[model samples]
Target: MVRNTLQMIAAGCGVLFVAGGAIASPAEVTVANAERRLEAGADISMTRWHVDAELILVLEKEASRKVTAYLQSRGRLRVVDVSVSINMDDRVILADFGPGFLPGPDEAEVFLHELAVTLRHYAEQAGLPIVGVDFRYQGKPLKSYYPAELAVPPRARIDARNQTALVSASHGLVRVHPALNWDYQRPDAFGFREDMITPPYGDALQRLLEERSGSGVNRARNRSQDPHPESNRPWDYMSSRYHLKTLLPDRTDIWNSLPNDTDADREVKEDIRARPLYANHLGVGTMISLHTNGHELGAIRGVEVYYHGDKPDDRPLAESVLCGMRELIRAQPGYENFPARQDASPGGHGENRIGTMPSVLVEIAYHSNAEDSVALQDPVFREASMKGVEKGVRLFREGKTCEPFVLQQIPDISLAAGTSQEITLPFAGHPQFPVTMEFTTANCSSPGACRPSKTTFDDPNTPITVLMRCRGSLTGDARWSVVLRDVDGVATAPVEFQHTCSKPGGSPAA
Candidate 1:
C-alpha cells in the first residue's frame, strides 16, 4: 500500500507539502513564488528538441536506498530508468527477503519528497519547470509516472501507439503526452532477467550486423587490443558507449542510426528521444553521458558536467551537474575524502562541438585515486552520482546557460560532390572530437541522390579538392555550394560557390 500522509521535507519555502489535489492531471509545479499546482495546463512549450540520450550512472549496488533517493528528488520527473549492478561475489544469502536493502515505504516517500523539493529549488533558479519521475533500478524498469492519457487513443495497442497508466492510486487511468512518441506498453517481461545481458539494440539492429561490421570505427580498431571485461578502461581510452555493436537497440538504435550510415553524435542527438528524461506534470527533458576520465587532465575526483565546447544548450545542464556532483560526492560518507568544488566549473578543453545536443559526460571521479577507488566500491557513490545527474536535468529544463561551444578549427577538409559535399572535419584538440562536414550543391547533373560517394581525410585539416569524372551534357549556370553543419545539432553555416558548368570542356560550357 502507498502512503498518503505528507511530511515536511524542507524548512519553510523548501518544505515538501503535498499539492493536495487529484494527480490524474497534475500540472507542472514550481516554488519560487507560486503555490503547488495540479491543473492540467497544456504545456505548449514542450517539444522534442534533441534525441533523448540515457543519463547512465554506473555503480555496483544491492538495492541501495540512497541511490534511489537521489533519483526521486528531481521534481520534474516522468519515467525513471534505474539499473543496479551488484557485486557478483556478494554472499548476501537473503534473496527471499526481497528488496530489504532498499528504502522502505516511509523512507521512500520522504526521500522522494526531499528530492522533489531540492529539484524544484534548482528548477526555480534555472527558470525551468519539472514533470515526470521514473525509476529503473536493478535493471528492472519501475516508474512513479503515467503516460499522457489524452494523447493515447483508447483501444489502440500500447506497443504500436501511446498507452499510459497512472502509478499513484489517485491518478486513476490517464495517459501522458509523452515528450517523445514512445510506447509505454512493452512485451511481456518473460526473458527479462536482471542478471543476463540483453542485446543493446533490438532485432532491427542485429539484422544489419554483417553490413555494419565493415564500418571505419571497427575496421580501424586494432583487433588484438581488447579491454578486460572485469576492469575499466583508462580515462584517455574512450571505449565508445555508442560503438555500433555494443549499444542497446531500444530508442538509441533508431535515434542514433547505430551500425548504420550516419554520424554517431548526430545519431545520438536527433534519434534517441525514447531514453527517459525529466518526467513529471510539466514534462521537462534532459540528456547525460557517463564516462570515467583519467590522466588527471584536471582535478581527478567528483563527477563533472561536460558540455560541447562549441554549443550552449548543454552549458547550463553541465553547470548544474557539476555543482550537484561535487556537493553530493563530498557529502557521501565513502567519497567525503575527495575535495569538492561547489563552483562546478566545466573543463571541456578538448573539442569544438560536442555531438549537437545539450548533454554532459559526468566524469564520476578518478579511478586512479586510491581514496576514490575505495569510494567507488560503495553504493553510496551511485547515490551521489544520481543526485548530480538529477541536478543537471533540472538545470537544463530551466534554460540556464553554462558556456557556448567555441568556434575553433575543423581540420583536414575533405570535400565531395553530388548531393552534398561530405568533408571529414577533425577538431584541433583531440582526435576523438571528430566531425563530418556535408553540404549539397548542383555540382552534379541527372541527380537521383548524389552524396560524397567517397571521403578521404587522414590528416583532417589539409584542404583537398574532389574530382568527379562524369561525362554528360552540362548546360546552365551551374552553381555549387558547401554547407558546414553539425549532424547532431540544428546550428549550421554554409558557404556557396557559383560557377558555370562545361560538358567535358565544351568551352567551359559557358
Candidate 2:
C-alpha cells in the first residue's frame, strides 16, 4: 500500500515552515490543476510556467516520491534524487536519475520503460499533454519514449510532386557542400566524408547547411568520381600500380569539353539543374559550392576558388573567399606552399554553370598532398578554413570584412575541493601570432575559487593551461570567460568555461 502521510518544507521570502498532512491522491492533484485551468478558460491539456531552479528541485522531489511509491508496490528498490526539465514549447519531459539508480543494464531498460509509462499516466491524469519523455542516466542520454500517435510519419510515403512547390523562397546565399568523388559505392574517394565539411566553414559564413545544398544533391550516388581507376586515384596509391589502369578525367584541360557522359555525371547534372530552380524560387542572390581538390602528384597544394567566367558578380565573392583562405593557409606551420588562386573560366564544371545566382566553387585544399591531408584531418585547421570562408561571405554581404583570430576550446572545468587542475585552451589561428586573452571568474561561491597561471597566449599551437584551485569549503559551480584580443586590444569572440567545484570529499554535481 502507498504511504498516506507526507511532509513538505515551505521556505521562501525569509520564512520557513514544515507542513505535515495526508498526501493528496494523484487523481485529486490532477483534478485540482485541471479545474483551475478550466475556470480560467485555459487549455487543460498543456501547462506552461516559468520555474526557477529551486522550484524545479521541489518538483523533482515530488516526482521522485511518487515514482518510488509506484515502484515499491511492485518490488523493493532504492530510490534516489531525480532531475526534471519541462519544455512547454516542445512538450517534452526530460528526467535524469542519479548514479547507480538501476541494478544493471537489463534492469535499467525495464525500469526506465516502466518509469516512462508511470510518469505519462500521472502527467495525463494531471491534464498535461506531454508529447515525449527523454530519460538520462548519470548525465548520459539513456532512452527516449514517445506515444505512437506522436511519432513522425515516414518520408518514403510522401508524394514528390509537392516537394518543389516551396522552392521559390528567397535567400541571400545558396551554399552547396560538395563531396570529393562520385563513387558512392566505395568510401575510398579522397573527397568522401566532405559532408562533415559544412559545420566548420558554414559557421564562418554565418550561414547553415539548411540554407543550401552543399553538394547540390541529397543522394549518395549523385556526386561521385569516375570508377575508372585512373580518373579517381587514391592519395596513397597514386605512385603505385594503380597508375596502370587509365588516365585521370581531364576537365582542367581547356581544350576538352567538361565530361557529362557517365551515369554519375548525368545524375549530378540533373541534381545541379534542380538547384537553380530552387534558388530562383527562394530568390537567393548567390551560390557557393565547397570541394577539396585532388591530383595524382602530391606535390601540388593550396586553395583554388573557381567562378563562372560569364558571371562577373561572382568574382568579388570568390576573391574574398580566396583572401580568407590565403590567410588561413599562411598561418599553418608547414603549409606555406598552399597559395590561394582564382579560376574564372567560361566552360567551368556543371555545378558552377547551373546556378542562376552568382556562384563560386571553393577548393579548400588539395587532399593528395600529404601535409594538406594531415591539416584537413585536424579540427583546428578545419575551423580556421571555415572562419576564412565565413569572413569572405560576410565581406560580400555587408561590404566589410572582420577577420578575427579565434581561440576555441572546451568550455567546462571541474575540480575537487582543495585540489588543483589545469585546462589547455586551443587556438585556431596562427601559432606564432601573439594573442592576448584575459580570464575572469564569476558567480564563485567563495573567494579564491580559481587562479590563472597566465592571462595571455603569445605562442602558436602552445596550449594555455589554467590552474584552478578550489577552497576546501567551496562547492557547487562557477564560471570563467576568456576574451581573445589583438595586441592593440581588438577583441574577438569570447569563450567561457563552466567551473564546477565538488563538495569536500564528495563527487561534483553533474
Candidate 3:
C-alpha cells in the first residue's frame, strides 16, 4: 500500500507538513498583539464618551487577516471579498467565495462546517469575540455558521443567520442607504418632496461617520448613489402629488387611486431589498434604511424605527436607535414635544427582512406635518438625529441600555374648553423602583391644568401608564410634560405632550 502525504496542516499561523494521510489537528495559531493604542481607549463602560474608530479599524484588519490566511492556505477557494467587524454580541465575517469551490450544496455545507471551526479557532487566538461567518458564491449565500450562543430566533435558517450578522454588528462598519433614488415621496406640507428632504439626513449621517472616523472614533461606510444633489436646498418644491394624476386621470387624487402595492411600489420594494444585498456584497455588518414618514393626518409626527420582528436582535436594535434619537432630539431647544412614537408592528418590512443581516428602516419624522417638515430641514436637527443614530449603534454594541422610559404615542386631543378630560399616556421601560411622576404644563391657557392620578410607581415590573387629567380653558394647542424621578432623585427629561382644545364651553370631542 502506498501512503499519501497530508495535503495541509496548521501550526501557529504557520503550515506544518506531515507524511500521513490523516488530517492534522487544528493548529494553535498565535496572532501578534494588536496596536497598543487599541488598549488605551478600549473602555466598554456602561456610559462612555466614544470608542476609538481607528482602533476598531485595526481590529477589523486583524480579524480579516486571520480568516483570510486560514482559508488561503486551504488552496480550494478564493476570497472575493471579506468584511469582518465587531457586532453587538459577536464578531461577524461576510466573505464572497470565488471559484475552485465545492461541487454542490451539500459540499458547501461541509465547507461551512469546517470554516466555522477554523473561524472560532482563529478568533479565539486573536482575543476577538466569538464569530459568525457567512459565505456567498456568485451572488448567492452558501451555508453559513453562527456561534451557538447567539440568540437565534425560532427556525432561523442559514440566510437569516447571515443577515443577522449585519444587524447585530452594533459596533462594526455600518452601511447607510439613503432613500430610494427613483421614488419621490409626496410633497411635504411645504411642497418639498421626501426625496429632497430625507437624503440630506442620510448625507449628514455619512458626514458624521466620516467625521468620527477622521477624529479616530468609528469608520462609517456608505456606498449608495446620491439621488438628490439638491438635497440641501429642500426649499425648492417639486410636488409628486399632482404628477400621479397624470398616471391616473380618472381618479381625483393619488391617495385614493393608488393600490396598496403598485408596480412603482414593488419596484421600490425591490430596490430596498437590493441595498442590503449590495451592502452584504461589500461585507458590511449593519445597515440603516433612512426615511421620513408621510400621512394624510398631519397630526401624526415623530421618530419611528421599524425592525424585523422575527429576528431576535432586531427589536433591541430598533429600541437602541430610537433611544438615541429621543435623547438628542429632546435636548434641542424647541423639540420638547418630539415623540418617540411606537414603531409599526415589527417585521413586514422588505428592507428589514430580505437581508442576511440586521437592518432597520427609520422614519425620522413626518414631512406631512408642518412642524416636523421644518424640523427635517433644519441642519441642527439633522445633525442631532444622525449623531443619535451613531451613538445608538455604539450603545447597542456595548450592550448598554438607553432610556429606560420610552413614551408611546400621545394622540391629539379635541376636548371642550373648561372640561377636564382623563387621557391615558402609555409608556414602556424598566424604571428604577420607587419612581415618582410629576406633571407640569407649558404654553397652556390654564395654569395647573394637567394633573396625574397617581404620582408614584413603586414596582419595577409594572408598565408605566399616566392617567393625566387636563382642563382646557381656551382654544388652541397646549403642552403637558411628565418627569419621572427615580429613588436616587435622578429625573428624566420631560415627556412633552400636546392637546388641542375647542373654545371654552363647547361640546367635548375626542
Candidate 4:
C-alpha cells in the first residue's frame, strides 16, 4: 500500500491517477484501518495528497457501510451502483449513486449525508484538502450538501412577543361537499382509520404545545375562548393567545375544497399542497405534519419521522423530533423496545416538500401493525408522543442535535445448552462514523462463552453481533454491557443486555 503525503504545500494540488482492480469488499474497509498519517503538529487545512481507484473504493465502502448494513439486516434496500470523485483544488467531493439509491425514504438522505461525511473525513485523514461534499443519484445532483447547508443554524419563528407553531394532522374531514380524505386505511383489521386517529393527536399536540410554551397563556386564553365559544369552526383561536397554529382538518376545516370539484386523490393532492401554503400565508416558519403509517407488511411497526430531502434545513427538525419521541416513547412501560424504523428519512411526501420553511412529517406509529394500533389508542402513548413533538420543535430552535449513537433495547435471549446463536444488536443515531466502541461482559460463565463479533471496532453505524454459546450445558442468566465512545472520548451511558442459558433439552425460561 502506498502512503501518499503532500510535501508541496506552496505549490499546486496533486491529482489522483486512475488505477483499477476489483472493488474492495465492505468487510475489508473497516474504520479501524483508516488511520491518519499526519504528524501531531500538522495542520489539516494545509495538508493535500493524491488519491486513486483503491482509495476511492475504500472510501465508497466505508461511506456506505452504515446504510448498507442496516438494509441488509432488514432484508430490503439495495444500491445499484456508486462511484466517488473529488476536485482537490476546489475542495469538493461528489459521489454519483446509481438507481435504487434514494427510494423515497429519509434514511436515504441520512445514508447520502453519512456517506458524504465519511468520504470527506477519509480523504482528510489521507491528508487530502476537502471542504465540502455532495451526492447525486442517476447523474442528477441532489439538492443539499454537507458543511455548506448546515452553516445556518435552524431557528423557528418563536419570538418572545408572540411565538407561533403549525401542527397539522395528516388526514382530516373530507365529509363535506367537494372535500376528500385519502389516508392509508385498513378498515377491516383496524376500526378507526388514519383520518380518525390523527385529529385527536393534533388536538393533543396543540394543547401540549400551548402547555409546554406556557400554561399561564392557556389560563389567559379562557376569556378569549368564552367569546369564541370553541366550536368546530376555523378561527385564530389558538394563535390569539396560546400561539399554536394547529391544522386539524378533521374538525375545524371541513369545507376545504377547490372550485374545480374533483375526485378524492386529486382533492387530497391539492390539500397537501394547500396546508403548507396556508402556513406560509400565516408566516409560520415551521411545520410538523402528524400522521400514522401503514404497510402491507403488518409486522412493520415503529416511529418514522420525515423531512424534505432537498431542503437541508428540514433535517434538524426531523432528527430532533425523532430524538424527543424516542426519549419519551421508549420510557413507556410496555413499549420499551419499540424501534424508530430507519429513524428519520425523506419519504418525498408533499407535506414536507411543499413547505417553504423548516418542515417535518412524522409517521408516529404504524396503524397497520396490531401492536402499534393499540399504542395509537393509548392515552399515555399519545401524550408522550405529543410532548416529544413539542420538545423536538423546541430543541430544533435551540440547534440541538440528537445523541450521535443510541443502541436500541436488546431483548433477553434463551438458548439450549451446547447451542450458539448470533444476535444482531440494532441502533439509531445522528451518525458521524469512524467512532470507536468497546464492549464489557459481566457474569459470563466463561471467557469465550459470550463474545462480540469485534470487541474493539472503530465503527458504530452498523449493528453489532454478539455470539452467545452455552458451554457444557451451562444453565443460568448472564449480563453484558457496551461502552460507546466517540473519537472525542465522550462515552454514553452503558447499555446492558441479558441472556439465559438453558439445559440442552429442558424448556427455556418464560
Better of 1 and 2 by TM-score: 2
Worst 10 residues of 3 by lDDT: 1-10
Give the per-residue lDDT digits (tens) of candidate 2, residues 116-223: 534433343343434446666667643223223122222122221222111111111111224333342112335534434332343433332223213221210111
* lDDT tens digits, residue span 1-510, model 4: 122221121122333222143343333332222222121223434434355555576656554555566567657667455677887655567777766555332234324543554565456444454545766766765444333422332444544343466777655432222432222322434777775577677777778777655421111011122333233323322221111222334422322424354443343434455566555555565777887876544655678787765666677788888877876676567766666632356544555665666778888897878999999999988987887787777667656665545677778778887788987766655333444556677767655666653354445445666677776766777787876554323345678878788877777632
Per-residue lDDT tens digits for candidate 3, residues 1-510, read 000111111123222212123332235222222112122333222211212233234334433444455467655445433343334232344444444443332122223433443443344333332324545554454323322312232322323212212221111111123433433434435866665565566666656554542211211222234332333212222222222223334643221322343332333332343444444444444667776766544655678776754465677768788877766676567776576542232433445654455567777887777888889888878887877776566556556776545556567666666655666556655333587877667667555454433388787666556543334354555676777765433356577767767765565433
- List TM-score per model, in order: 0.26, 0.34, 0.38, 0.44
Q: Which of the two, 2 or 3, has more TM-score?
A: 3
Q: lDDT for each of the candidates?
A: 0.30, 0.47, 0.48, 0.57
The residue pairs found clashing in candidate 4 are: 106-345, 106-346, 107-345, 173-250
Q: What's the candidate order when arranged by decreasing TM-score?
A: 4, 3, 2, 1
RMSD of 3: 23.3
For candidate 4, the C-alpha RMSD (Å) to the true structure equals 17.9
> Which candidate wins on lDDT?
4
